[model samples]
Target: MKAKNDAPLRSRQLIGYFVFSILLNGFGNGLTVAMNLGSALWTASAVNLAHALHLTLLTVLLAEGVAVVLFNALVLRRLEWRRIAGNFIFMIPFSFLVSWFAQLIGMTPLVALPLMWRVVLDLFGIVCTGVAVSIYQRLNVMLHPNDDLMQILRFHFLHGNAALAQPLSFVPPITLILICVLATRQAYALNIGTLFSLVAQGAIVGLADRVVFPQLKHRHLVV
Candidate 1:
């Protein structure tokens, strides 16, 4: 049997990995965003999109979720309202949590830390993001729009190669960021952390799949 089927992994199923992933993802992303040292590429893209459009992060995130859902349906050539509903379910509360966490952290002194320390914090946030993504993606139960897109590509298109699918799923954000830069002549949250995120997020998610939570595996999800 795969390690995913082991007794230990089964034990982990009782710990609510979904809930854990939500908090971890929210906190990691919020910290990086609030600090603005850099954040994951997609998050930065969303931030830039928000700035470009003069919208709240939550609004942009939710709107992006809807857009991706349609894109996903296009790719699959079918509209699965149940899957779309789940995407909304994931983004609505999760977006609120992300905003809340960023607001909370912005109020604290952590955002004003020295350059080197802030870099470290931002990098750590990236790592947390990778781990959080790994857990939830492997669980393959509930997922955000971008993540759902990743899963769609990984399984249906890429034949389960996450490293390939992960980066490919970033097209929307990359496009948005480009649009924002063209209009504003600058990008928000594009920095060292974002660079690292562009290169490392997929690999980190791949690594975390095996090391961070070896028991959890992609459950062969279908949308």
Candidate 2:
């Protein structure tokens, strides 16, 4: 069935999932910023670009969301304006939450922490990202626009070739970060976390999809 045509889940239930997902996302973002490194590949690129352009990270994310929506519309030959708009609206709260969490964590203090603790935070961030992404996928309301773009690229553009599509989705984002880093002479955007996310996010998400989503499905708690 077309995603647009699917019936809406109960409002209360869906909202609960949304809240939980956003919290995870916000916390993960906090850890990323606190570690003074990239937590996710696409995020790294977006953050770097935002820095280079002297724009707020939220602004860059919103722009990227719009671009993804446009790209999806072009490829699908149909515009799901509601989904696009929903995702765009979702970004505002997400940005604020991330900012709040980032501030709450106190980046300066986090950076000054011992190296072992920093590694722990990085791992925690990755886990948060993995679980949050998985829950978001199961909720089936609206995707974090770029995620939807990645799906479209994987299924529509790559024709279900996971091998190619998976890596393709990551390469551009990391490459963008690399370019900006070299040009601006700023290495903050690319770090151990970036490499960790590139390698581990897939495994983590895959495990969640295989193990977590199934349990949620069994409980009839998710669509």
Best by lDDT: 1
- Candidate 1: list runs displaced more than 4 Å: 1-15
* Per-residue C-alpha lDDT of model 1 across residues 1-223, encoded as one tens digit per residue: 1223223345456358888998999999998998898888778988998998899999987888888888989998988787788888898998898888889999999988899999999999999988998898887666888888887888788867778888888887888888899999987898899888888888888899889868666764642
> Ten consecutive residues with minimal summed lDDT in candidate 1?
1-10
Tens digits of per-residue lDDT for model 2 on 1-223?
3233233567897788778987998788767866765567777777888888899777876776666677667767787777678677777677677667767886467778898888778778867877787667566566777666555565566653433454566766777787888899986546777777777775666567567645442121211
Query: Each prediction's Cα RMSD?
Result: 3.2, 3.9
RMSD of candidate 1 to the true fold? 3.2
| TM-scores for the candidates | 0.91, 0.82
lDDT of each: 0.84, 0.69
